[model samples]
Target: MRLDGKVALITGASEGIGAACAAELAACGARLSLTARSEEGLRKAGPGALITPGDLTSEDTRRAVVERTLERFGAIDILINNAGIGSYLPSWSAPLEEARRLMELNYFALLGMTQLVAPHMRARRSGVIVNVSSIGGKVTLPWSTLYSATKYAVNGLTEGMRVELWGDGVRTMLVCPGYVQTGFQKNTRFGHAPDGVVKARRFAITAAQCATAIRRGLERDARTVVTPRSGWILVALSRVFPSLVEARMAKINGTA
Candidate 1:
């Protein structure tokens, strides 16, 4: 996936990781098509990009975004499924509607965008799909269980796409980022994260750093990318010592 001169469509390009990716990809000489709910923020984040400002949860918006990107660039060499929202409510107690809405954007919308672009990529037999999941997807966050669920779904889908699309010459990459410095906490759709988790921002990587990792992953044709690298240690620990990890997470959520 040489980014130079390639057409990359990125969702959630308004601010945070998506915005950072837009800039990073452009710097790598990729042509950009950016979509988000904020027209103004997209403008700032992706200058000279084909901006489609709308809700990704809408089927029409998803279609128009893919159609318009092809209209402008003639081909989509890369798809970055980055548009997603978070929830802090416990899965058992959260409103069903809120949980549904979270899944709609974080999981369903991502799947919809992939479905729309996958055919074109398969036709060409060349493309990369990048799904922006979270470290929470690998090791669940007790405080944000619902949010973690969406990311876990993303991880599953990305893995499946990798195998399913490999014969077509299409590659899929899963990005699991640990606490990137962004407004994600402030902009979550539901309740706030526990104070301990919020205070952990001091140790988090910047969105730009996360974006850089994504770009590197694309260049190397990686299957999975865990930003900050060290996040993998946590993931490994969770797998080898599930009860220990759960206890620590419960403490972070102030539940123990």
Candidate 2:
């Protein structure tokens, strides 16, 4: 609902969309508790923003971040599960362990943080949980199959959680962003993007645009938010013409 004076805990708060969310929320009058592996980056989020630097894959780190946030704010009005890794490896040859690792951060960690913060939100009877998925979640992207799989899991979980938490006053929102100009590609957990994929970055939106959509979605208690607005056209196209979409994706990714 109203963001004024609310306390939000955001993971992956160091840079990119996460940093933009932190700034946007802060401007909305929400206090922020930010977590990431970069202390320096976290500090840049804002002077008043609480910084919890650590690996999100670790349960200990998750616990510590939540505990510290609660200890400082006494309540968590918003939980933004924005910490995630990307994989560009082809499923046919991608290592299983790497897949698992990607899931650990992208899906499992999001689940863990939600599990920890949900009870608190339920008890308060007023809160929001924002899961940052990707447009890939809505439509599978070739050569990044595992990444899409993880995001698809996010999309599913956010939906289920939204229904399960209905009338609980705890809103769940899913943010599905198209390619955004961020360090995501350079820091991918496994495999680099093909030349075609890299070239596609030319049309990517900025991280701030994605963050703005996320903030607006939270304010409106939206069920799902697909950023770059036009991305919705692609999602709709995929649903209406799956074969055409798949064939095009395969060609774009050099699969066929």
Candidate 3:
């Protein structure tokens, strides 16, 4: 369905992909609850957009965001679980607390927001939940093991949730994309990636392109949307030939 009159909540809308998605949905007439830790960024990007400035990892913040959406728009039809953070690191080099914190936003916040919004959607008998994961969620990249793991959690979660949520009139879309030319890497904690990650940075997509694909997916209510074209081929290969996919990734990591 079209997003013409719907209300949507998108986390991490201060910039990057989240910002672009908010712009796209708002362009389609969806009232927006755009959230991020940067209040200034939200104000600058959104201007007239409703802003929720807080760390979404907090349960209180998550609840407040949904509540505010309900307050302003009266109903929440679309929940875009797009806020994610990563500290480029290997399993050991990564700080345990930092990894846990990342999971809090990338995994827990996503689930929490869905739980808060789903009942309303179920009662209303229609809604959409778009979980923005990554190509890294589908496969591990060197120096980004912890980030990959968190995304893997999201990948599994949205899949199982989609099956159970389907009959409730909630459609879940898991968006897996290759590297976007966003500040995702620069903004990352970089647990041990002092030299930087070469592999992931190479095959980069753009925020605008990613947003366009997401809009089309939400419009048609597609199950999963992959961007940069090659993403589809990689995902397809990973499903049937996981070993091969990992092997290919291993080679890429070797260079990184």
Candidate 4:
């Protein structure tokens, strides 16, 4: 979709890829509605954006965000569901409460935002929905299995939405970013990545780079976007050699 003069509502706009997307989209001449739990961070992310700072997991917050954005922008031309958290704990032993909380933000909150905005888009018959998933969504990362699960769900949701919204002229784009240079590690809900995974950051791409890729994908109406592009190699390997991929992931998680 052409972003010029469009209104884009982006969640988790406080930092990292979300923040970068806010800037990138704004640069593309799209009016911005930025939201996150940190008002201060949102301010820095989009100085001229419509800011709605709150926990997206709360139904009230979600309603207020959508209501306020529509009030200000008249319409939401694009919905970027980027608010999510990670869990580094082993899925088998992770606290159930923590897992549920992670799912609330990463999955449920995204669905809620879509539910609120999709009707408006459907009526207009024009809009783009961008769901920020992870490469781990396509190929499980044993070190962050719970996080992977949430992204896997996101992938499914994005794909289904694409088909369901096709007749309406609404587009859904799934973004699978490999290790990004963000505060993701420090801000995870709980636990730390294994040292091997931490070291892999040296090869990670910047949030700005990922944001640029997202914008390019939208311009071309791409169905699935894998930032760094090379991440597709891993995804392909996982599909063609599942056991080999699983063994490598197990070694990364120190389980092999």
For candidate 3, the clash count comes to 0
Q: Return the clash pairs for model 1, or none.
A: none
For residues 213-246, what per-residue lDDT tens digits would candidate 2 score against the true structure? 9989988888889988898999999999999999
Candidate 4 segments exceeding 4 Å error = none
Estimate the TM-score of every prediction: 0.99, 0.98, 0.92, 0.99
RMSD (Cα, Å) of model 4: 0.7
Model 4 per-residue lDDT tens digits across residues 1-256: 7889999999999999999999999998999999999999999999989999999999999999999999998999999999999899989999999999999999999999999999999999999999999998999898889999999999999999899988998889999999999999999868999998999999999999999999999999899999899999998999899999999888888889
Candidate number achieving the greatest lDDT relative to the actual structure: 1
Q: Ranking under TM-score, best-scoring first?
A: 1, 4, 2, 3
lDDT of prediction 1: 0.95
Total backbone clashes of candidate 4, pairs 3 or more residues apart or in separate chains: 0
lDDT winner between candidates 3 and 4:
4
Q: Which stretches of candidate 1 lie over 4 Å from their true place?
A: none
lDDT of 1 by residue, 1-256 (tens): 6889999999999999999999999999999999999999999999899999999999999999999999999999999999988899988999999999999999999999999999999999999999999999999999999999999999999999899987998999999999998889889869988999988889999999999999999999999999989999999999999999999988999999
